[model samples]
Target chain A: MASKGTVSVEVSDLRREFKGKGSPVVALDGVSLKVGQGEIFGVLGPNGAGKTTMIRILSTLLLPTGGWAKVMGFDVEHEPEKVRRVINMASGAEKAGYDFISAKKNLWFFSQLYGIPTATAEKRIMELSEMLGLTKYLDRKFYALSTGYRQRATIARAFVNEPKVVFLDEPTIGLDVMTARSIREFLKEQARRSERTIILASHNMAEVEAICDRVAIIDKGKIIAAGTPEDLMRSLGAPALVMEVSPPQSGFEMLSRVEGVKGFTASTEEERGLSTVHIVVETDAAARAAEDAVKREGLKVVASWRKQATLEEVFVALVGRGFKEREEQDVV
Target chain B: MKARALVRLWSIFGEPLWIVVSMGFPVLSSLALSLLYYSIGAASYVGFAVLGGVMVSFWGNVLWSMASQFYWDKQEGLFEIYLTSPAPISAILIGMSVGGIIGTVPSALIVTGIGWVLFHPAVNAVWGGVILTFGLTLASLYAMGMTLSSLYLAYGREAESLNEVLQEPVSMLSGLYFPSLGARSPFPLAIQAAASLIPLTIGMDALRKTLFYGNDIWQVWPDLAILGVMAVVLLFASTYALKYLENVGRRDGTIGVRIR
Candidate 1:
C-alpha cells in the first residue's frame, strides 16, 4: 500500500477484548486496513462498532490484545513512545483540558508535554486559535467556554504539535451545523496544506462524503467495505430515485412489479398531506416506470428525479440497516 | 518538564487567599495545640505539637496533590491525554510530587518557625544533622504517601474517605502530639514497635531527638538508617505498584475514566 514508506498507518488483524460484565466482549476482531501518507481516511460504523477502540489502539492510548498496528512505521505496542511522539488524537467522549486554566495555558501545557519549543508552541497556538475562531476565547477559562469552543480548543490542542498522524473520533459530534461544517473544512485544509494523514471516525455520512478521500465501513468489529466514496457508490450497480406525491398513496407494489424498479420506501408527512418515496432502480427508464406506476395508483405526482446512490445507501446495502436504526437498536 | 511542574505548583497555590488559608490553617491548628500543651503544664512539649501540625500539613499535600490527583486527572480527562503523550508517567507523578512539596513548603516553614520560637528546645548545635533528618523525614513520608496513592488510584472516590480516615490515627500513632516511649508514655513497648514501622513515626522521633534533644548524627543513626531503608522500599514498591496497576487498568479500560 502506497509503496511502503508512504504508508502512514498499517493495521493487521488487530484485536482487542474488554472484560464485559460477565464475559469477554470483543471490541475489535481481526480488523485490518492501511492508510497512506497525506490521505484523509474516514471510518464509518454504528454503535459498538469498535471505531473508537481502533483509534485508541492506533494512537497508543490502549494496547491491543492481539495482532499489530503501526503508526508512522513504529509498532504501536512495541514502540509506543516513538508512535506517541508522532501522533495525536481528539475524541468527543471526554473534554481534554484543565477546567480551571485558560485555553492558551492548556495548549501550552500539552505542548510542553510534547516537548515543543516555547517559541514554536506560542506561534502554533496563535495560528491554530485564529484559524479555529478561538482567538477571542483563548484567555477565557476552559470551563467557561461554550461547548463548541471547547471542542475547537481540543482540536487545536491535537494540532499544536503538528503531528504526522492524527486521529479524530467524532470530532464534530454535538456541534451546530455551522460549527461542524467549519471544522470539516478546516480538517480538509489542514490535510491538504500539511500532507498530514488524518483518520476521521464519525457517524455523519454526509460529513465523511464531503471530506474523506477514502472510507471503510466497519460493522461488528469488521471492515465490511473500504474504498473511495465514488467507488463504493458505483459498486451498488443502480441509481436511487426520489418522488414527491400528494395525498400520500401507498400502492408501491405496482412500482416494484415494474421491470427495472427494484424496490421503494414511502414516508408520509401527514400534517402537510404529502408523501416522499425513495425508489431504487436500474436506470432512468425505471424511474419513469415507477412514476407511471404511482400515477396508475391515482396519486398525483408532484415531482421526480433520478440521483446517484449516496454513501448512506451504500452503507445500508452493505450493512443491511440504516445507521440511525442500528443506533436506536443499540440503545434498546 | 520543569516549567510544567512549576505550572502545576502555581495552579495549586497561585491565589493569594488560598495560600493564606492553606498555610494559616496548619499554623493556627498548631498554635491551638501548643496553647493546650502550655495550659496542661507541658509547655516544653509545644514543639511536639507544632511539629505534628507540620506533618498534618504534609499529609494534606500528599492526600490532595499526590494521591487524589489521579482521580482528579481522570475526571478532567488529563490522565488519558498524559497516557497518550510521549512523556513518561513517572515524570508526571514526579512533577506532581514536586509541586506538592512546593505548595506545602510555606506551611512547613511557618510551623517550624513557631515551634523554634515558642519552645526554644535544647537545640542540636549541629545544624547539619538536623537538616538531614528533616529532609529524610519529608522524603520518607512522601514515598509512603506515593505508595498509598497507587492503592487509592484504584479506589476512586473512596480514596477521599480514606484520606479522612487516615488523618488523626496516623498522627496519634506516629507520636506526632506525644512521645510513644519513656516511663510516662501510655503506649506499650509492642505498640511503639509497631508504630516505629511507620516511616513518619521513625522520622518524627529522629527529628525530635536531633532537633530538640541536641542528639548527634551518630546518636540518631539507627532512626536515620531505618528511614532511609523505608524510603527506598516504599519508592520501589510504589513504582512497581503503579506500573502493575496501569497495565491492569489498560486491560480493564478503567484508566481513562472513572470506574464508578
Candidate 2:
C-alpha cells in the first residue's frame, strides 16, 4: 500500500483551454485536487463540467494549458511515459477493440502492450472474464455484444494491467441497474483488493455515493463542494418532510401550528382518495413530531417520508437546475 | 524488446492472411495480362520477373499497408490502447512495419514463380543475391507508407482526400512502372534522379540489370549504396514522425474522440 501521506494524484492550479480560430474557451478554471493512494475519489459534474478533461489530463493523455499535475510522483508534462505506466483510463467516449475482432483478442493485444508475459496474460484474462461475467462471450466479436457487456469488458481491460491508479469516466452510464450495481461492486473490490487509487467521474449520484469515499461536485469548471456523501447532504440543512394520507388528516395541521413548523401545502388526489401534504419542517426533529401527530389523529398514512437532500440536489443547488441543457452556454 | 515487438506484429497480422493475399492478387493479375501480350523473353527473365512485375506492386503494397494497418487500428480503437501503454510508440510502428513485410512477402514470391514458368528468363543468380536490392526497397517503401499513415490521425476525414492528392504524385515520382530516362531537361531529370536515389528505384534498377543484362553485383554498386542509404534514412524518419503525431493527437483528443 502507498504511504498514507503520499498523494497518488496531485493537481495544482490546473487549467485547460481549447484554442479556436476566434477565441480559446477555458475548460478548466484553476481546478485543483489531491487524491491519496488507495482512495476512491470522485468528481461529480453534469455535461461540460470538464470532468472528462481533468481525467484525460491526469491520465497523461492531454496536456494542461496552465499549471500541472503529477501522478504517482511523476510530473505529467515531463515524465508522461512514467505516468502512463502507473495508470490506465476508461472513458465513455472510448469505443476500442470493437470492430472485426473478438473481445478476448483485443484484451490479449492490450496485455502485450502492458508487457505482460503471454502465459500471465492468458491467466489474467481468464480471471477477469470470470469476475466480470464475460466468460461465455469472450470469443464473441465486440460489435455483437450489448453495451453492458462491452463496458464490462472495458472494465476488465482496465484492471488487467493491475496498475496502481485507474481513471473511470461514466463507468456505469447507459447500463441497466443490475449491471451498474455489479460494476460499482467490482470497482469497490478492485480498490480494496489491489489497493488501487480510483478516480471516478460520473453524474450518477447513487453510484457515486455507493462507491466513492469522497466526492467533489464540479460546476462551471470549479468544484463547488468536496466531502463524503453524508457531509454533503448535511450541508444542505434540515430536509422538508412530506406525507400522503388516505383521509384528511387534522393532526398535521396541529403540527404546522407548532412553533418549529414553518408552513404546509396540501393537495388532494381524487382518484386514490388520498391527500398529499408537504410540510416545511424547520428543525430535523419536526419530522418525528409530524409523524406522531399523523398517528395520533388515526389517519391512514399511505407514506410518510422525509425529502432527504441527495447528491443530485447538491449538484443542482451548486451547479444550477439547467446544468444539463446549458453546459455550453457560457463557453467564453 | 525486439522479440516483444515481433510478437506484437505476429498478433496483428497472423490470422488474416487474406488481407495480404487480396493486396497481391491485383499485381499478379497485371503481370498475367502482360504475359498474354509479350512472351517472357528468356534473357534476364528471373530479374525481370522479380523487378518489373513484383517491384511496383511491392511499393503499392507499402502504401496500402500504411493506410490500411493504422487506419484499421484508428477505427478499431487499438491506437488509443497502444498510446496508453508502457511500450514506446516506435515499438508499435516497427512491429506493424514488420507485419507489413510478412503480408507482402507471399506476393513477391508468387510474381517470381509465375515469371520463371512463363518466360524462362535469364538471371545472374550470384549477382542478384549479392546486391540485396529487393530487401532494401521493401524496407524503405514500408517506412514511407507508415509516415503517411501518421498524418491520418491529424487530418480526420480529410485523410482520404489528402491521400488521394498524394497518390498520383508519389507514384509518378517513385517511377516504379517507367524508367527514369536520365535528365534530358533539368526538371524531369532532377525529379528522375531524385527518384532513382530512392531505394525502390535502385532495387528495381539493380534487379533489371542483373536479370535482363547479365550484370553482376559490382556492376551495380551505385544502386546498392543508394538503396541502403534511403532505407536507413526513411526508417528513422518514419519512426520519429509517427511518435510525434501520436503525441499531438492525444493532446487534441483526436485519438479516440468520436466525430459525431
Candidate 3:
C-alpha cells in the first residue's frame, strides 16, 4: 500500500436530511470518516444506506444540512467550486452526456467543463479510453454503445480530468462479472499508480473486501463498522458454523440450547428439506457441541464446517441482523 | 465548447431544422395576418405583422432554450454532472443563453429578410435608435431567460408550468392599436396595458418607434434606458434567485431534481 499521508477527504458529523412528505427523512446523520490520500476507501451498505448521499455531498453536488465536509482541504459547502475542480464523480448507470454525440466527444465536452485545454483534453480522453477498454468505442455514438461500453465510457469521463479525488458510486453495477472484476482491478491499479484517492460506494461485499484499503459498513444511514476488512472480521472473534442437515427442523431446537453461540440463522430448502444453518459461535467447542446436539436430535448432519468470519458475519455480529432483513432506505 | 458545437451544428446541418420550423410558423402566421390589412386596403401597416414575427422568434428561444432547459437537463441526468462541475450552474446557463442566441439568430434574420422581400414595408430606420433598441431587447430578453431558468430550477414543476406559455407575444397583439395594423390581434386594453409593463413589450415598442417612425435616439431613449436597467436587474435577480433556490434544495435534500 502507498503511504497514506495526507487526508484527502475529511467528513465530520455530516448531517443531510430530506423533507419527507409526511416528515423529514434523515439520510446521513452525523456520519464521520477520513479517507487518506491514495487509499481506495469503500462505503459498503445495503440499499438506502446513505452511501450515495455521502458521495454526492463530498462531490459538491448536494449540500449537507448540518455538520461539514471537506475535500482536499476545501470545505464542500463554502468552497464547492474549488472542491469540484479537484474532484470528479461517476455513478453507475448515470444517463449523462448527449446521446447523439460520440463517447470521445462526451468525454471532451465534460473535460472542457473543468477548463482542460483541447489538446490536453484529447490526449487524456484517448488515454482514459485505452485504459478503460473503450478506445474502439470512442467514436461510436453514446446511445449506440453496449451497456458495458457505455459504463466504461462514463468511468473514463470521470478520470479524464485526472482529478485528485474520484467518487465512484456503484461504478461496477450492471456489468458482467468478468467486466466488473476487470474494472475493479483497473481501479485498484489506477489508484496505486497515480496515487489518487478513490472513494467507492458499493454494496458488493466481496468487491469491497478485495479492493478497499478500508471499509465502512453503513446500514440505515449510519456506519456500523469501519476498519480494514481483515481487522473487522478478526475483531468479530467468532468462527461461523455452516451445516447442511436433513430433517433439520427438530435439530435447530437442540442447537439453540448450545452455549457460546452468539447468533444463528437457518435456510431450509423445500424440495430436499435440507437446511443450511449458519451459526456464529464464540468458540470451537460451541461448534462441536452444536453438531453433536443435531445428531442427538435424530437429524442427519450431512455436512459441516468451521470457517473464518466474513464482513457479512461481522455485520450480523454488530447489527444483530443480516443485511437482507432491513427495508429499503430511500435516498434524497 | 458549446459555442463551437453550435457552430459545428450550423456547419453540418445548415442552420438546423428548427430554423425552418420556427421561421415557418411565424412567416405563415404573419402572411395570413397581413391579409387582414390587404383586405381592408391598409397595406402600409404590413410592417407590424412582419416585425412582430421577427421579435417573437427571440422570445420563443428564450422561453424554451433558456428558461425550461434546466428541467430537461434534470430529466436527462445531465444536470447532475452540471451541478458537480467547477463552473457554477448559473454561469453555464448564461453561456447557454449566448449559444441559444447564436443558434436562434439565423432564423430571426431569415424571418426579417423574408418579411422585407415579400412586404417591402418601407423603413427609414434611425440607425442609432434601431441598434440600441435591438441590442437592449436581446440583452433584456436573455437576462429575463436567465432569471426564469434559475427560478424554474428552484421551484421545479410550478415554474415549469409557466413554460407552456410560448414567448412574449404581446407585441404582435398590440398591433391592434393601429386600425390599419394589418392583423386582427385579439389583445384587449387590459392585457395591452399589462403587457406594456414588460421589458420585451417596451423594447419592441421602442424598436417600432425607431424603425417605422424613424424616431431619433433621443425620442426612443427612455425605452432604451428602461431596457438597459431591466437587463442589469434581471441579471442580478438570476444570481440571487439561483443561490436562494439552491439553499432550498439543500434544506429539502432534493437538489430540486437530483437525478431526473
Q: Of the candidates shown, which would achieve the greatest lDDT relative to the real structure?
A: 1
List DockQ for all candidates: 0.46, 0.29, 0.37
Model 2 chain A weakest 10-residue run by lDDT:
A317-326
Per-residue lDDT tens digits of candidate 2, residues B1-260? 44334443444354576555654664565466456535544332334434555665566556665655566666665666677778876667676677666756666667767766766555545555444656666766766666666666656666556666765666555544444434322236667677665556666666666555666778777777777777677777767777787677656666666344
Q: Point out the worst 10-residue segment of candidate 3 chain A by lDDT.
A: A323-332
Candidate 3 residue lDDT tens string, B1-260: 36334423433234356557767876776777666766788876777667777777777777877888777777666777877777666667667777777766677787778778877877878988888888998998889888888767765555556766534344444342242121233556677666655777777777778888889999878878889999999999998887787766655566625433
Please tell me what DockQ candidate 2 reaches: 0.29
Q: Over the stretch A73-115, how does candidate 2's per-residue lDDT look in tens digits? A: 9998789899889988786556766354678876877787788
lDDT of 1 at B135: 81
Per-model lDDT: 0.81, 0.71, 0.77
lDDT of 3 by residue, A1-332 (tens): 11258999998888888877998888888888888988999998877779989998898768888899989999999988799889988888586766766788778878888888889999999887777788988988778898888888888888888889999999989899877887888799878999889999988788889999999999877887899999998997877989999974623656657887666666778788798877778888988898888888778899998888887777766765455544321322
> 1 or 3: which has the higher lDDT?
1
Residue A96 in model 2: shift from native, Å?
A: 1.7
In terms of docking quality, model 3 is: acceptable
lDDT of 1 by residue, A1-332 (tens): 22223899999999999987899999899988899888899998887899988998898767899999999899988888899899988887678887666899889989988988989999999999988999999989888999999999999998998999999999999999988887888899888899889999988889899999999998878888989989888987988888899888644567657887655556788887888877777777877887888898888888887788888777666654557656766778
